[model samples]
Target: MLLGAERGAGCYAARVLAKRIIPCLDVHNGRTTRGQQFGRAEHGELRDVGDPVALALRYDEGGADELVFYDITATAEGRGAMLDIITQVAERCFMPLTVGGGVRTLADFRALFLAGADKVSINSGAVANPEVVRAAAEHYGSQAVVFSIDAKKRPDASGWEVYVAGGRKATGLDLLEWAVRGQELGAGEIVLNSIDADGMKTGYDLEATRAVARAVDIPVIASGGAGNALHMRDVLLYGEADAALAAGIFHSGQTTVGEVKRLLAAAGVHVRLVQHATLGW
Candidate 1:
């Protein structure tokens, strides 16, 4: 559990921050992928978008607030994320880069940072060994640690449960409780991925997002179920998420990061819009 000194401090400090538009690259075996839920499109499938380096370059030109790369199968396969991709992306992207999947120790965080990752995200590792969260924060600052949580609604309609190992196992932990504990444990931010909303295109599970956001003091990034820009607006405003992460909508060419940011701006949300470097401001 987080101490009283840590509780809600991060959240309060971030209350006035601009809402971020993040593009997520779900990589499998070195290729970017998109699927309806957590399912990965097979190697030859058209859903295997292309090289992550190319996609990162595109998003960088499009004015994305940040880039997130998740090695979708790393934890399940018991290996680390490909460092070559992170190195390539860091060299090309000017914005912050967050890498996740298969992060299990301080060494993992060290390797990711040394390889050009601005931040490291840990899900299963944090759940399995909560001490790693503290260790990472101690080694690096808490600001460099992002704790990702995969959550699903309970069968009894009670609350959400934490899922780990690429959403394959349940931890029987309450979503709200885990988020609070994560903040207490020194995580700088939280990425709340909704299993129920994964690939649904029905918009985010605002109920789950709001519940977790209210429970913690850190920034909460809403992930999954984003079919369009309206969904991103809803999550940032009503759901109270500090950032919105989308994979399918952007990967499938259904939407662009600029489109999402523009829509949110029109809807009265504060976001970083890149004015034309072509024209003097």
Candidate 2:
């Protein structure tokens, strides 16, 4: 278990901060759900899992380093982060929580912080005005700001293009260019979520992740497409990502945070120690 001094306001630990495991909870219509490839459900409809708070508690028990609560429909619907859910989860879970989806202005960031969010993530908002990244990072410090980029491979397979508004709107921004811009604008970290690989559970897009990781000086969190421990290991080591984020695999009980961390540790990767982990637990 994590000690009192260890669980601070910041999401990352002092030492093993970059190499960490994060679990994402995507909520649609107030219920936690999972789908393939950014809203495309392979089975025709999304699998409504359960309450997000319940899932957060379960992931917390599995020893996730950080938890991300994304209101999947908030931005598309033109609203704000789910304060009710954030407050509820913050009241219970001790781990760092990042809330995103529909965060537009500085006031939105303030409200999220007041509700006990450790970090505020902005996707469409940042794309709309890159200056917001600088403003938020300056006001709250880069540590509290997470710039999330949803990218899809172009039709010509030349490179990836950034997407926003629930992956329905294309911004025509190059992945590497925007990643560098986000860092230049003072983003503490960048979450590179692949539209093509999301929820596929095959593995992360290593080439894209490595590119973004190398492009930005800040920590790059590789999101989307996590199947098993080896897949995560490949991304963290080979992909050169500072961290890995997953949703479907863990939500479906195919794996747990502890399981992934154990594998990474056994492979000589640095990860926060969890209870019962052989590597220093």
lDDT value, residue 76 of candidate 1: 91
Clashing pairs in 2: none
Residue 79, candidate 1: Cα error in Å is 1.3
- Tens-digit lDDT string for candidate 1 (1-281): 33211332353345339999899999988999876657743434326788999999888888887889999889999889889999898777776788999999988988888787877899999998999999988867788889999999999999999999888899998999999999999998999999889888999999999989899988999999998999999999999999999988887788888878888889999988886563232
Q: Where is model 2 more than 4 Å wrong at Cα?
A: 1-18, 40-44, 276-281
lDDT of 2: 0.85
Please identify model 1 stretches exceeding 4 Å from their true place: 1-16, 40-46, 277-281
TM-score of each: 0.91, 0.92
Give RMSD to native, each candidate. 5.1, 3.7
For model 2, residues 112-206, the per-residue Cα lDDT tens digits are 88787888899999988888889988887788889999999999999999999889899989999999999899888899999899888889999
Clashing pairs in 1: 2-184, 11-217
lDDT of each: 0.85, 0.85
